[model samples]
Structure formats: structure tokens, C-alpha cells
Target: MSSSDIFIGEVIGTAVLILLGGGVCAAVTLKHSKARNAGWLAITFGWGFAVLTGAYLAGGVSGAHLNPAVTVGLAIEGGTEWGKVPLYLFSQLLGAMIGAVLVWITYYGQFQAHLTDREIVGGPGAQDTVKAVPNSEPGPVLGIFSTGPEIRNVAQNLATEIIATVVLVLAILTQGLNAEGNGLGVLGGLITALVVVGIGLSLGGPTGYAINPVRDLGPRIVHAVLPLPNKGGSDWSYAWIPVAGPLIGGAIAGGLYNIAFA
Candidate 1:
């Protein structure tokens, strides 16, 4: 694909990916939404479908490496050229932010209703009380925008993200081998979507399976900047785990593939 194709395809593809993926999270978490309390299975399946849709949309144009981890893994595996890496990463991040904004717009009313409800925030006047770090934690709706750990252990959280992302990028890398080195081909999107769901079901309990650095960071940035009333801090302190762990995992997967699978 040409540079413009890659750029356009990644921006659109990644926007769709975050739109549906984060959209599912918002559906399950936010108030006054039909899919509220839909549980983890719903989220995993929703993300899988999101991946399927985004990948299928951009596959023909940019090979649809929507996740930066996938892009990095492929580059290390010699599938994508190093020169194109920056474009892919930049486009993915930009697309992810756009998608997050779309999610906010799609569920604007729910967000407003949820944030204003005292019970949702904590209690009466909780909105004013729920301050950042020194006083309290991030706001209630932050989870809809970014991943956070159920348990706050740095090593454990980092390891879980790395392992899960390694599984994701490795699965993507090997799919080409199964297809006789023809790339993902027609089944690639579906296969990758299923793999994402599998990872979520199996390993998502820890850090919400960020697996892709841009996926988490882009939306988290959006969360920080959006003018949502009563929304708390963006949890910038723990943000590095999602960004660093997946990147490290992608590089590791690439090196491992070269050593064994390639």
C-alpha cells in the first residue's frame, strides 16, 4: 500500500476499532444505557466484533494493522517496513482519539446523566469531593475510556499486559505462516477478532488487556481533556503500564518469531 493508503486506512480502521471497542465499554458501564451491566462477556464479544469490522474495512487498503503492537511485531518480523512504522503508529493514535470522541458523542446523554447522579459518583456532593490522587481516585467514567487494573500491582499488571499482548501479536504473526506467507488474506480479520476475544476472556481480568498502546493512551488522553462534569483524574500515573508493556511485548514477539517461527 502507498503512504496515503496506509495513513487513511489506519486512521479509519483504528477509529472504527476504538469506536466499537470503547463503545462497548461505555454501553456496559454508563448509566441509562440499554446495555448497562451487560457483564464481561458482552465487552469481550463487542471488542471482537469491533476488531472484525475495523480490520475488514482497512484490510484491503493498509493491511489493517490497527494496533501499534501488531505493526511493531510485523515490522520486526520483516512484514512491514521500518520506514512506515511512524506513519502507522501516528495514524493509529489519531484514529483512536477520534474514535473515543465519537463514543463520547454517541453516549453524551448517558455520560451527563451518569456523572450527575450522586449515587454514581459516590454519594451526595461526591462530585465535589472526588478529587484527584491526594484526595481520591479517578472519576467513575474513566474506565469507559481507558484500561485500569483490578489490582494495583506494577509488576503483575505489567506482566499480564505483556503476556496477553505477546499472545495477540504472536497469533497475528503466525497467521501469515498458516496462509503460506500470503498475509492475513480474507480470514485475517475474523481470526484476529476471535483472538482478541479469547485474550479478553482468558487474561483480561488483570489490566483489561490493553495489548495495544495507542488503544489505551489515545482514549485516556481524551478522557483527561473532555469537559465531562464530575469526571475525575485521568490516572496518568499508571498509564505507562499499558503503553510500555504492549510495546515491549510486541518487540519480544517479533524477536521470538524471527528466532523460531520465521
Candidate 2:
């Protein structure tokens, strides 16, 4: 495929990925939505479906490497060319940002209602008995857009991201290797989608299973820049964990694949 094809495919595919994925988070978290408080099962399946749809739509053109970590892993695994890496990353990030904006637009009323109502959002006993770090000026709704660790231990959080992402990228890399070197084939999208759901169900509790740098960072950037009422800090301080861990995990998966599976 041409460079334009790759760019357009990734942008559109990733935008849909984030729209449905982030949209599900909004559905579950935001107030006054029908799916509000629908719980973790909904989110895991929602994200899996998001991956399925996006990959099926974009795989032909760009191999549907929606996540930068996946792209890097593929490149390291020799499935993707190094020259094309930058284009993929840029397109994915841009698409993620666009998708997040769409989510806000779709759930504008819910966000406004949720952010404005403090009692409903962070009630009297929101923190529980645990001693929470003091945030003098907290933003309320950033969680809808990005992931945050339930427990804020930097090393643990980073390790969680790395471990989860390794599983993700490794599953992706091993999609369809056969004596024929068939390589993922049509079943790749569906299988990888299920893998994503599994990761979310099992590993998401720790660091929200970001596994994808652009998926977390792009939306976080949107949350920081957009003028949402009481949309708390972007948590830039914890941002690097998601980005760095997934990247490191992807690279590790690449090396492992070359060593054991290639």
C-alpha cells in the first residue's frame, strides 16, 4: 500500500478504535448515561469489540497496527519496516485525539452533568480509609479519558504496564505463524481482539491496562487541553509510565519473538 493509504487507514481505524473504546468508558463512568456503572465486564468487551472493528477495517491497508507499541513490536519482529514507523505513530496519535474529541462531543451532556455534580462524582467517602495524596486543585473527570493506577506506586505501576503490554504485543506477534509462515491471516483481528479483552479483564485493574502509549497519551492530552468543567489534572506526572512501559514491553516482545518464535 502507498504511504497515503497507510496514513488514512491508521487514522480512520484508530479513530474508530478510540471512539468506541473511550465511548464505552464514558458510558460506564459518566452520570445520566444508560450504561452508567455497567462495570468492568462491559468495558473489557467494549474495548475488544473496538479492536476487532478497527483492525478489520484497517488491516488491509496498514496491517491495523493501531497501537504504537504494536507497531514498534512488529517493526522489531521484522514484520514492519523501520522507515514507516514514524508515520504510523503520528497517525495513531492524531486519530486517538480525534476520537477522544468525538467521545466528548457524543457525551457532552453526560460529561457536563457529571463534572458539575461533585457529590455524585466524588462523594463524602470516595477515598475510603486509605491516606490519599493531597491535590489542592483536583480535576474530576480525567479518568474517563485516560487510565490511572488504583494504587499510586510508580515502580509497581510501571511494572504492571510492562507486563501487560508484553502479553499484548507478544500475542499480536504470534498471531499466525505456521510452517507456511501464514502470519495472523484473517483470524488475526478477531483473535487479537480477544487477547485485548483478556488483558483488560486480568491486568487492567492495576494500571488500567494501557498497553498502548498513544491510546492513553492522546486522550490524556485532550483532557488537559479541552475546557471541561472540573476535568482534573491530566496527571502528567504519572503519564510517562504508560508511554515508557508499553514501549519497553513492545521492544522486549520484539526481542523475545526474534529469539524464540522467529
Return the top candidate by lDDT.
1
* Pairs in steric clash, model 2: 139-232, 140-232, 176-184
Candidate 2 residues 159-190, lDDT tens each?
Answer: 99999999999998887533322235588889
Q: Could you tell me which 10 consecutive residues in candidate 2 have the lowest summed lDDT?
A: 129-138
Candidate lDDT (C-alpha), each:
0.89, 0.84
Q: What is the lDDT of residue 239 in candidate 2?
A: 88
Off by over 4 Å in 2: 121-138, 177-184
The TM-scores of all predictions, comma-separated, are 0.94, 0.91
What is candidate 2's TM-score against the reference? Answer: 0.91
lDDT of 1 by residue, 131-153 (tens): 42231467789899999999999
